[model samples]
Target: MEMRSLDRSTLGPENGFSQLLKPWPALNSPFKGAWCVVAPGTSTTRHAHPDYEIFIAMTGEATLSSEGEEITFRQGDIVHFPPHTDHQVINDGAEEFQMYAVWWDQETAGRFLERHDGQDGDRDGQEG
Candidate 1:
């Protein structure tokens, strides 16, 4: 077993967003977790990735835009997006918007998406 501390985590600031405690570029893992801070009145550019991603708001609020829809997410709300799904988060609040963001490889992500998508097939060919 291993233990880590959030206070010792690293901060990466880029393109109007800052990611704290990313496991990569230092540690190795199929999944990575980060505490993302979006500065007030700032926004992230529309982008897509090959990994499944999720964001859970921990403080303040933000507006998420994707697929022609915009939704406001408050503290304690969660958002999930599949691979290659273009999305952007805008911090339009008066305070910094903080959230927990997680990403994993496509294979691991496939399981979650498949289950929710009502797919009956599994990697072992078992029926759900």
Candidate 2:
């Protein structure tokens, strides 16, 4: 049983957001977890993992786009993404968006979503 507090000082910005990854090199955990901080007007790329992903809002609000559907969620709300489904989250609010995220089957999930967004950018739930 390993236990530790979230150290915000260790969080780093990446892909338009600041995140605290919990899976350390020697942790040997089957899942990957993170505390994500999405800056206002920023959005995460439309991406998918081979395993299930979960997100719990910790602060602010954002619009989540899964497949072609969109919904707004705020602090305290929980969101779940089915395996291998594409999704994107955008923070349109004036304040920074924050969430606690967890991905099951870290190995498979990492292999599947290794690539970041391409030229298309964040999926806008639009059909071309």
Candidate 3:
């Protein structure tokens, strides 16, 4: 597996996506897509992955949910989920939120918005 360390500067304030990691630049179809995500104390705008996903929290504590139920994850916790799993997270700890989210495709993102209250999550990062 080809692996590359993502520099910290690569992450910045993003629309909807607080932090982002473009592991797969789309040039390589069927790429192993991965992203670094960070959420503040407040809840993130609900979203989803069009493909299978894996979330790795780098630091701090967070509450992630896929329906009405929420699961709390401390530092070093890893979460594995399937495609179309509508989820959202918030960092409750007194620090910046950080997590690496891995997904398979752009369609997976749409499933996130579908689970929401009919709110379309067609933001910039994924499909428009």
Candidate 4:
């Protein structure tokens, strides 16, 4: 079994947040997993990709913007993002916002979308 840590020292800045666990051939994982942290008053870039993604809020609170709507979430909340939808997250709280994210490959997302009748299961997106 492979083991990894989410320690701050292991993360690097990407876009506008600190993240780690990016997918690579050496990882041998089917999907990408990341530990992300957004500082107060910061936000991630609004972006989209052809992969399905989900985020688990681990600390603080933030507002997620997607498909013309803003949703607020806090620790213990989970959010899903459909492929190709533009989305961004803003940390308005005083503390840092931390979350765990996972996303599947495009081929896997395509198959899942097909099974779901092409209706986007969720209306948010994220950058790898």
Candidate 5:
């Protein structure tokens, strides 16, 4: 991924219940980028990215966990995870959850994303 401003046009729609701003990243571009926002009371299926991911919440709250620690995150909170690590995001709020996720491949990139086709990921619903 190349270095771009916060207003990257290629990033599609906002993700969550609110007007979530993604400004997402490109594939195999040599950079990891943030794909932002998940709706409140909703959640993305548990999963892992090929590059390290960072979750930033600007509004509402979220239930996020890695390993055995489960925590709720609110505004001004930033969560970081390394590649291939398990992570889950759950919107526990009543309103929309606005978030920004920044991913990096070289640990020096503006953003990067490794799409997992439901292979290696956070599977909260598929567990025994």
Candidate 6:
């Protein structure tokens, strides 16, 4: 088994986050993991990708904006985002908001989309 640690010191200023695990052929990982810490009054870029993702809140509270909807989540809350869904996290609280993010490979996401087609309405997986 491969073991990795969460090292905040490695977090880059450009992303305010650090990648923990990723699809490495040698490691045989099919998913990616990241540890993110959003400073107060800051927010992550509103973006989307062709990969299924889930975010687990570790501390503080934040507002998750996705698909034109805003949802509030606190510590221990988990949120899932389907592939191609635009999302952004805003740390409106005084303390920093920490979250662990995991996303599956694009191939896996494609298969999931095919299986769930039209179940949640048409999702062309394209940005508007």
The candidate scoring highest on TM-score is 4
Q: Any runs in candidate 5 off by more than 4 Å, and if so which?
A: 1-30, 107-128
Give candidate 3's total backbone clashes.
5
- Quote the positional error of residue 50 for candidate 6 in Å: 0.5
Give the per-residue lDDT of model 2 (tens digit) for 50-94.
878899999899998898999997999998898999888899889
Model 5: lDDT equals: 0.61
Error of 4 at 82 (Å): 1.0
lDDT (tens digit, per residue) of candidate 1 on 45-76? 78888988898999898999988899998899
Candidate 4, overall lDDT? 0.78
lDDT of 3 by residue, 1-128 (tens): 65556666665544234434442432233334444456565656676655677778877787888767799976799987776778777767677666766566555444444534232334434433
Checking candidate 3 for backbone clashes, the offending pairs are 48-112, 49-108, 50-107, 50-108, 50-109
In order of appearance, the predictions have TM-scores of: 0.68, 0.69, 0.59, 0.74, 0.57, 0.72
User: For candidate 2, which ten residues in a row score worst on lDDT?
Assistant: 112-121
lDDT for each of the candidates?
0.75, 0.74, 0.61, 0.78, 0.61, 0.78
Show model 2 residue runs off by greater than 4 Å.
1-18, 25-28, 106-128
Per-residue alpha-carbon lDDT of model 4 for 37-122, expressed as tens digits? 98898898888988888989999999999999999979999999988988888998899999888889767555554544423333
- On residues 2-52, what C-alpha lDDT tens digit does candidate 5 reach at each position? 554544343344232222233334333444345455655677667776777
TM-score of 6: 0.72
